[model samples]
Target: MSSKREEELLECPICWDSFNIVENVPYILWCGHTLCKTCILSLRWAEVKLPTLPVQLPLFVSCPWCQLLSFRLVWKGNLRFPRKNFFLLWLVESANGNRVRYCPSSSCDHNFVLPSNRSTVSRNGSSSSSEYLHETPRSSPRDRQRTNHSLLGGWRILTLLMNLTAKFPVVIIFMLIVLYVIPASAAILVLYLLITFLFALPSILVLYFSYPILDWLVREIIA
Candidate 1:
């Protein structure tokens, strides 16, 4: 049997629902009180006034337990809420028999992995069931998987570029030649040809006309 303190830790004060990995993910406020994501969304949604126009305006979310007000902005018809409490989430997962493992590499897309086996006591001496309300969850596995794959692909591309730049000094020079040097050289050559043609044309016309005018004047003077 779980103690009263353990039960309190596992459940949200507002909805009285046990924190889970899905819908009731734990979120901590600036005032140090923890609430489930559903309750937080509910509070924010309650304060939303009917939009006079299509644009949804910002609203203040007040904590039910402390009445502490938090200013939140409406982004694309969704309220931007506080960050999830990962420590509390780990505790919840741990209490529910889910073992959390972190990636060894710092550059990993997913920070931690949760695998469920059997119920166990967490470091904080809390044990709970995995059942949770099917309220609107903040995140889904498919979303997370998609995000991880996108991030991993981006990282792979970045890593490949970095490796190419580092391993072969010629690659950097080749890129510079392709992206900057070649274009600049072509522009400079074109400008040089244009300037030479402009200057030479004016000088040749001036000389051609001057010779005839000078000879005519001299012939007139001689005659």
Candidate 2:
């Protein structure tokens, strides 16, 4: 059985829920505190927004314990996801008696499972207390080899493309010159430029309009 302090350490400060490997994974904040992933997602919506500032600006969330503000970059009106605290996750799993073992080989990315009935033996032949190992079935060596080959082939193709681009920069310049020289390609280029400008115009306008308001807000916040 885990101690009271250990149980408290495994619980999220915000939700008061115990951390688990599945839904309640522990995510560490910039302020050196950990919270559940669900609570972090909730914080995104709870962040205070400056009505006068542009909505595209990064959002800030105050830590529940320290009140220290942490800025999260916005992507499509959503805050950037925080990193998971794997160490805390391991501790939680160990406390729950679910011991996860990884493959000893550096080449093998997948985990191999040990039988729950067997005791895990150490290098010195000492037996440790057996725990339930929950892991997916390991891939065969042939499958691993094929996967590695496929990844290597993909990297080779990418390197070939990069080498071609580096060796034949003149070809790219010639293609660009031809595009402008030809009326059809020139019209296509113009249309592409127009589309890009149309897409970027709204953001530009928002920034232009919100500059003054943002300046005032910064001064007020700093003061």
The best candidate by TM-score is 2
Q: Per-residue lDDT of 62-175 in model 1, one digit per residue for the tens? A: 667655556555478654667676766765765454222322244333443543554668899998555332222244556545644654455456446544534465667789
Worst 10 residues of 1 by lDDT: 98-107
Return the clash pairs for model 1, or none. none
Candidate 1 to native Cα RMSD, angstroms = 19.7
Top model number, lDDT: 2
Per-residue lDDT value at 33 in model 1:
69
User: Candidate 2 overall Cα lDDT vs. reference?
Assistant: 0.66
Looking at model 1, how many pairs of residues clash? 0
Q: What tens-digit string does per-residue lDDT give for candidate 2 at 154-216?
A: 545644664464447567778868876687877989999999999899989998989899999
Candidate 2: the clashing residue pairs are: none
